[model samples]
Target: MEFKNAKEARQKIREGMWTKPTPGLAYGYTQANLVVLPYKYALDFFIFCQRNTKPCPILDVCEPGKYTPIVTAPTGDIRSDIPKYRIYKNGNLVEEVTDIKKYWSEDLVSFLLGCSFTFEKALEDANIPIRHIEENKNVPMYITNIECKPAGMFNGPMVVSMRPMPKDLVQKAIDVTSRFPQVHGAPIHYGDPKKIGIEDINKPDFGDSVTIKEGEVPVFWACGVTPQAAIMRVKPDFVITHSPGHMFITDIKENDLALF
Candidate 1:
């Protein structure tokens, strides 16, 4: 189904019409990663994002117990607007739900983090091929040897999303993405996934793998999923996050976040 705007897309998700990974939907609008935590852990997590801007760039944060993202999408409800949500208890993923209204609490806080998906439209506009989008699959993501700066009880390896493109377009891809710092600007690593601790490019820690065509090299970008890695290591009592590749579409436009 094609959506004319972010609001229409989010409404469909809220009504259970779309229950898959969101990549090409709401073209030109921003897409965000979600992290819902208890109020007690909010400050520390916010600081963690501040220290690791590439992977955890803040888009909009809801007040404790609030589900609406007043800044990014005022009409959207974080609990129901996302296609899928992961529920974690003691850091273990316990359930994947379409909506989190049942888990709502007065003590929980919602954070919207910039997603790489937001910059994909720009990449496509520049004639850069996005493999997973072409294959109708989720973007491949992996945990790396790169450790994030520790913040309070949160500290873990950075997670990255990979896209393989023609070797010649690597520099152009970097230039296109570098303009959007809020959506993980630029490629962190363009070749040799092993150098970043990825044992096998085919087996990603999250999301799905796509074809790496001949003459193409895999490029990696800091992923918003990094917080989920920290949540797993820290084993917080309870938390909620958007399922990998399932993001919340926002009313904000892509160019609004670009440097130029």
Candidate 2:
């Protein structure tokens, strides 16, 4: 299920042709995390993202009642562009669907947040293996003890995605990813997941665990899913988000986001 470009990939997803995780598709293009909330909570969530840029770098924010991410993927519909979506009501997950058109409303605001997946092409180019991708599984994610800077009613433990790479490539991976700060920059921690309150590296709070090969260390990065943690804690009345590992592919090229 390879595609020529981001648009094609998005179309496939839009038409229900692809429902799996989006990692290996649309290579070299930027991918994003989705967060749709009511107009009332939009401001608070935006502030939360501003105060916690590492885990919630915003790529584009649609106007209230809008679904198009004009800046990143103008032709795309946030309601169906993502392969999968999660619906939450009063903090409880109510359903997982392929599209949210039925849930659309004028009071809803959609946000496209920078995703670590955006930098994976840079990582692959550097020859640093992405373990979960290699294993055909979702990247392992954990909710850390580190609390994000509180903003309004939004605050919770930071969530991080892990990629197990050889000990030797750790520095190289950091150097490569550091150039793309808009997509979570670089590895925040490596070697010990316990230091971040992960009691079991084999069991992640979100996504799937992968093989941490011999001589490989688990590298962690700030994840956009951090907002979901806050949503659950705050128990907002209604919200929608892309399922973990499933992302919205954007028209922007991956290299375009690099600081270098």
Candidate 3:
């Protein structure tokens, strides 16, 4: 769990020394959602993310065939930086691999999208409890009734990640996260799971469901997984994305990403 910097952490991933969720790894740096698509679909997906900034805040995009994410992590290789990747063929998950070098090609474009983990430190500093981290589990995420605006062939329901916190700290969590718009900022919905089309809060579509205590309310934030949901519906020929909680750690510091 200890790394000198984002690059070093990524090196560990590249070497296959680390193959797990990257929440507590590379502390103080930003973690990003990875999306790799064919050159033909790049423009549409880019526009799709632009249209739905709440769930798909874009941080950087790599040109076709390029693996180096110059804007987010200049020296990092997108092919192996993330601990795990989900390979989708015609919208169905076909493989989950640690290294994607075999799938690398000149027709692929990589995107690094902002993640909510950028604001975890701020919330902890404010004394707000993050139940998932406390329990050493992945943040719970759900596919919702909220639909994303269509951009070309990409369109699907907006996905959200939930965090259970005490009622008293909800406002503080909102305030802390709102300062970082580059990350998914603020809670989109809170209190009721059925309101968002989540039939059972105890069971989540993605990631592990954590305990919701007596005084706690489940706060939902727009998730980076929205893009993956879109791909699932669109049925693209080939797509690469980080597994739900396995993100690509970036060189950018969290403080540099905050708005105020």
Q: lDDT by residue for model 3 over 1-260, one digit each (tens)? A: 68988989999999999897877777778999999999999999999999999999999999999999999999899988888999999999999999899999999999999998778878888898878889988989999999999999999999999999888888999899998888899989999899999999999999998999998999999999999999899899999999999999999999998888
Tens digit of lDDT per residue, candidate 2, span 88-206?
A: 99998999999999999999999999999989988998899988888999888999999999998899999999998899999999999999888899979998888999999999999
lDDT of 3 at 233: 91
Model 1 alpha-carbon miss at residue 140, Å: 0.4
- TM-score, cand. 2 vs. native: 0.99
Off by over 4 Å in 1: none
The residue ranges of model 2 lying beyond 4 angstroms of the native Cα positions read: none
Q: Tell me how many clashing residue pairs each candidate has.
A: 0, 0, 0
Clashing pairs in 1: none
Top lDDT model: 1
- Looking at model 2, residue 208 earns an lDDT score of 93
